[model samples]
Target: MALAGLKVIEIAGLAPAPFAGKVLADFGADVVRVDRSTSTMNLDVLAQNKRSIALNLKSPAGIEALIRLCEKADVVIEPFRPGVMERLGLGPEVLLKRNPRLIYARMTGFGQEGHYAKMAGHDINYLAISGVLNERSKSGKGQVVDAAMINGVNYLGSFVYNMNKAGALFQTPAGTGQLDGGAHFYDTYKTKDGLFMAVGAIEVEFYKLLLKGLELDEERDKLPEQTDSSNWPKMKALFTKIFLGKTQAEWIKIFDLTDACVTPVLDYYSMPTPTPAPRLLRTPAKASASNEGSDVFLEVGGHSKDILAEAGFSEVEIRDLVAKKAVAGAGLEKSSL
Candidate 1:
């Protein structure tokens, strides 16, 4: 719990926004979600271990109340159209001025400043612009795989990963700014069984060992360019041959010891526990959203009765919110995985 003592304020929204808050809170930060006053407490698995304060952000008084929370918060998370928060008078400019050390996190489909900044888009559109989608496709077959994986994986890594690294960028011991960290050389390599291995980094030793493990002619040279004409056929043939001779477990054993970076490709569920090197561990929690339930990492808070009280939930308000879908708990069941 490196972040055990930090305090965060989450301006409730969908998907990645809530996700970011959860990651921080799970890592032992005090995350208070400012839920929509009329929002039902649909507790998704990712939201486990976090508390909620139901409030109407549209109300000026409500917005002001959140600003006050921001003044005491080390970080704030909001995902809205670029200036929507600004219009609500809760933008970074206003809040950041009040607390200069505050980490004002804004999550959006596009970035805060760009031609598409103001345009409406979702995860697919964002990946499309970043060259991620095109690269994910093979030979332009027009098939759409789990693009949500790209969105969730990349965005989660970006926000949570950067949140951990944000302390590095400031001039003083502590200051605040934004960071956009995305995936680099993490992807799949072709296999002999017509399967592919999703490898990462492709480091020098890995390149050498891959050449060695495949038993390629030592004198044969590797092509540097990644274009179709340069990469397919020959490389695919070799990979197919190398992997065709062995099961995935066999290959994992051979490569696991070397710096030869390699991993067997798997769908989300098929991935093994204690996965390859540089493994990350986070608290386990179940969350549900839009009728879909899955386990997710949670960033949590210190228990406080007053914090819950400040949420202003009357017995009637609580019952009504639940009845009308205004509040939710971590309404998730255990996933088999």
Candidate 2:
């Protein structure tokens, strides 16, 4: 429950990358957000509950300050194009040498090395490349990138990215390790009332219980049906259909009762219980517009300090960073979608 004395340094940036760091921070990591000195990120949702130190990574002093900060950090997260950090002279090699055990988490749309590594991207690109985006939107209209619009739209929505990064922190091979290289029993299914439940289990009997609880006909039809190794496709399809048929609460009723691996989908405002995701914990439900402690990083590519610094800068930054330059600070003003 507590990361205790662990220290994390997040290079001020976007949602998923920073949210990953926020998760670590909440559990007691001393998370220091390295904000761009000229960053107008006055209301960063992900960076809340953490400390902020503005530094112009483009400046030699700023980069050195970061290196000094890294010397005391256990992890440093950055979500730049493959070489942006290296180009800024703040790459893993420099930081790792200073802090050998430091988890140098490089968050990217594509991975460290790939055809798209150097290219700019977001969750959409990562999901699209892995075929997850396509798979999520393959039916009927066959949207080109609904995953891009929904899941791939923000940093936190990139569950694959966060899970992978968290894995690397706990595993060996240091920072270059894989994030998604764990057990493969991840799944989501629906209840009779049509709500979806995400499932994770390694035991065969657990999987059987899951299928049985969901009343998957295809799974029931399989021979030696009780075995976990039975073809999971039919059941998986049934699960997809069942969830698509109902709202999330109806499914939670039955799913939460069974010992089967399952959990209902929840959003920021609709957590079923006392939750612990970082953003939720740090943000004050009723904060003054001028509350000094709240800060979050809004990453925008292609800008110099002079351009990014100005009185109207925060609003302009918000607009440019968010949809059509609308300055919705930290999304607090917007109703939950």
Candidate 3:
């Protein structure tokens, strides 16, 4: 709901542009997708929580209508090749001049001005061009073993048994295994504020850092050897008491960046919710020939009467535009998540 009441005019296109609009819509922005009236490319995959108005950008009336929409909009999402908007007279300069506070976005594959700016590409194409395709995780050749989760976990017993053979596991009782909440450094401790902090400082260096962050002086505290299982119960007791002295937030302040493997066990409400991406905080989209541009048009939109009226289009003008095939009055037949 952070973007509620914000007006966004999204020039319909493929994944990148429509996805940006979808995110804004998800965050409660009032998005109006500008789709081509004659095209039937429905961008419903990312059209949730948005409205649409079909327009024939190739026509003069359609371009004028789009200008009007952007004149009062908080944001305009343009997904076209570099010169496409300029050729259609819908470039950012004209829109920003009409509404200086407007936020114009250009969603493109290669960007506004690049060797491939005007070229057609998608996620895979860009990844390939960026050499991401060459970076693949390959494993040693072996008999492939793919199975359902229920079956896969059962087969993993062979690997677990292999570890159990080296006297490296199950050395203690069921609750005292080194990685199974048995080691004091590999368990969760309660904080003074009733929250919990998870500790995984198993490595020697990490354990030292954890102790340092905990202010546990080696000489003064006379701590037992870390690997001495005979003294683990005592260590657990000490860690439990020490952790209870501070709140989770206080502990995080000390260990968050210390590489101590200590972190708060956050609940859903305590976690940071991810917001939309590719945003313009300052220096919003400006009109310039050298700016980024794209060339991808998708058809979608409806509710032309209401949207056009909001853009100051006259009742008669709206009817005439529709009559001229420059605008459409119906919206997407259906949309979903």
**Best lDDT goes to which candidate?**
3
Descending-TM-score candidate ranking: 1, 3, 2
Task: Please provide, for model 1 over 1-337, each residue's C-alpha lDDT reduced to its tens digit, 9 standing for 90 to 100.
Answer: 5467677887767777777776676566777877666554445445654776655566665665567677777777787767798888987678877776677766777666767877877666766665223421244222111223234446655755465577543222221121221111233555545556655534555666766665654466654432233344455555555566776666677677666577788766765432122223663322222223433323222222235335454455434433444333332111111
Give TM-scores for every candidate, taking all chains together and pairing residue i with residue i: 0.56, 0.47, 0.49
Steric clashes per prediction? 24, 5, 13
- Would you give me the overall lDDT of model 2? 0.54
User: All candidates' lDDT scores?
Assistant: 0.56, 0.54, 0.72
lDDT of model 2, residue 245 = 70
Candidate 3 lDDT tens digits, 296-323: 2223555666788787887678767776
Error of 1 at 312 (Å): 11
Window of ten residues with lowest summed lDDT in model 2: 140-149
lDDT of 2 by residue, 87-140 (tens): 888877788777665666666665566566567765456556653323212342
In what order do the candidates fall by lDDT, top score first? 3, 1, 2
Worst 10 residues of 1 by lDDT: 175-184
